[model samples]
Target: MVHENKHVKNARYVRTVESMFACPVCRASMKVVHYQSLICSNHHTFDFAKRGYINFMNQPVNTKYSKGLFEARRKLMTEEAFFEPLSHAIASAIHAHVAKPKKTSSILDMGCGEGTLLSTICNKVSSRGIRDVIGAGSDISKAGIAMASKNYSDKVWTVADIANPPFKESQFDVILSILSPSNYAECNRLLRTGGIVVKVVPRSGYLKEIREVLFHKATKKYSNEATLERFSKHFQVAEHFRLCYTTRLNPASMKWLVQMTPLTWSLTEEKEMSLAEEISNQITVDLDVMIGISPK
Candidate 1:
């Protein structure tokens, strides 16, 4: 048996969902041309990289996230199964809210760093018997999207700005924002009627152990009240679920956790090591999942 290259595999998958895309430059409809590039009516074409991901940005953008950070995140997510429960909850919400199981359901993961959560949730949804699911992920970080395309070939990955997503309006059945920044306006425009948005935000107790060690007393407490309020303003809140658990990680996993999160970005190498050592083993994960319906 012969194995297809990433370019061939990604092109085949993109053809199925070509109509979902809009030109990032002209906002015109786009179609896959010659199984190599996506060309719009205005002839603005975006080529797929050899590694199987399309870059939709007109100009390159710099982000703080690096290749090493995404790699660490993937290790923790896949090897440690640190986010298995949260992934399960998001998949369950999608399964419950998606109206027609027989029809092909389109899902977009915005701010999908490394694409692990998107791939995991899509797999879970498929396992629940919803086989006809189309999954796509986009992030501003080229590093993240590159890792995602290399690791998860089944889904379409793009390096795109979430604020100005390169997709047609009302194209998606479900939009997922998992512990990442969100663009509610774009989400409102991208979701089809009867579609749902799953937005996950961290609660005050989320990673409190690390916060206590790294932050001052005044800055240690975190809250999502503002985020929840903003989400409710854009869509009707349908269901809210809180997921909390404590996971004990080995020293290596703890090191990855510190490297993966932005909370440690400001810390010096010495401080990061100190914080990691102080946290020891047990860490708390507290999050709230919000299922929202776009208002008419």
Candidate 2:
């Protein structure tokens, strides 16, 4: 593997981060220190891991994003090849919205699971001669953020709450939220006046094979209407499209999918075992990519 000076590299990350965050407790400026935490003048401190990510959330957390869930997500994502098309869609959308003659720009991937999508976008942008773009991703799960930081040390990865991003206001050019929750007011607070928010949600028939095994009856809940309602409240549409792809999942990956995805959480032990037995090979994969622009 590769190892470099975290402190020196972190200085670059801190420079950009200070531009996207405010003190959640006091709304003052926060600074990045070698301790890997964001500290305010009032002495409210957050901890950063050896992997080079800091958790800016103030209080305790009680979400389903435990270490096990993050671990399962990593294993499945790495093995199942779920990110290729999604990354392409993200890169295409970013290219459409980004302007030229820019120095170092920033993109924050909120609820970035394992940093795959952001890393892919950065590499693609760099290939197109935009060497100064940065891909920063943050998640509530420490393990998730830790894995991302360790693997993609070249980028800025943090364990920050999007509700209160640990960076300055009006600093990011693009904010991405894929298969995660969003707070549009917070997103607007982070973006520049003309910045963009690229969000990805599941379409009507996303992950049907997994859903079939996990639930006896499945209903379409994550529709474009629900997301558009939220986005309309804060953002205007610059461009929008749907990305659809079909792929097959292996056995181990299929099992990991069952555990990692929220769809199977309600399944009983007996039902889960039966579902596992019923699966042989290949599960369907589908998702949508939505791109929106902040009102200038």
Candidate 3:
């Protein structure tokens, strides 16, 4: 099978996602023009890169989530099914929240890093007979969007700030934020009336093994109580689900697990080798899934 070039591959994503985009400068409605740029009513325009993703920022912003980090995460998740359970949970929540599964729906994944979680959930939801669904993802990191656009060309991938997303108001049916920062005000504005927001945050036990390996103390306590409190200010508090699971790991998968996380990204080759046995044994994934809605 022949692989399409970036231009051809991204053309579809560009079209599917164009309607939701607004002018970053003026916040006006935008449309795809000449298949090369997105033009708004006020005349501010953003161009599509050769790879087909749009750059909506006036200037580049630096972030720690580099190409290497995203690549490592993609490899780890794809190969080991690290976040498979979370993806399934998110997809199920979306399905349940949608009043009409057969009708067209749209989802925006805020701060999507290399698009694994969002891409997986979107594909899985479609497989369940939700055929007319569109997925879009944005991140402030250019490297993150570039990696995501390359792998998942079917979804809208953009290099823009998640705090002020470059999208139209009331355009999305569901918004997903998994272990990523949230701009509650923008999320509230972007969702349609009664739209659902599914946000996953780390619990105290999350990645305890890796934390122990690095800090020698995984006993520290943490809480997301403040996050829920803040979220309630924007949307009615719905339901919160706690998912706690333990994963057994082999040497190779464990290597990716430790390396892919920022906590261990600084581990020297020698240090990693020395601590290999301890970190490679097992890990815990403890997270809280909070579902919210801006009541109509």
Clash count of each predicted structure = 0, 5, 0
Kindly report which residue pairs in candidate 3 clash with one another. Answer: none
The runs of at least 3 residues in candidate 2 whose Cα sits more than 4 Å from the true structure, single-residue gaps closed, are 1-20, 34-37, 217-222, 267-274
Give the RMSD in angstroms, all C-alphas superposed, for model 3.
2.1
Give lDDT tens digits, candidate 3, residues 24-47: 888888888767778899988888
Q: Once all C-alphas are superposed, what RMSD does model 2 give against the true structure? A: 3.2
Model 3 segments beyond 4 Å from truth? Answer: 1-5, 269-277
Task: By lDDT, rank the candidates, best first.
Answer: 1, 3, 2
- Report the error of model 3 at residue 89, Å: 1.0
Q: Is candidate 2 or candidate 3 better by TM-score?
A: 3
Candidate 1 on 7-102: residue-level lDDT in tens? 778988999899999998889999988779989999999998888899998889988898989999999999999999999998888888877745
TM per prediction: 0.94, 0.85, 0.93
Question: If both were scored by lDDT, which would come out higher, candidate 1 or candidate 3?
Answer: 1
lDDT of 2: 0.73
Give me candidate 2's TM-score against the actual structure.
0.85
**Higher-TM-score candidate of 1 and 3:** 1
Q: Candidate 1, clashing residue pairs?
A: none
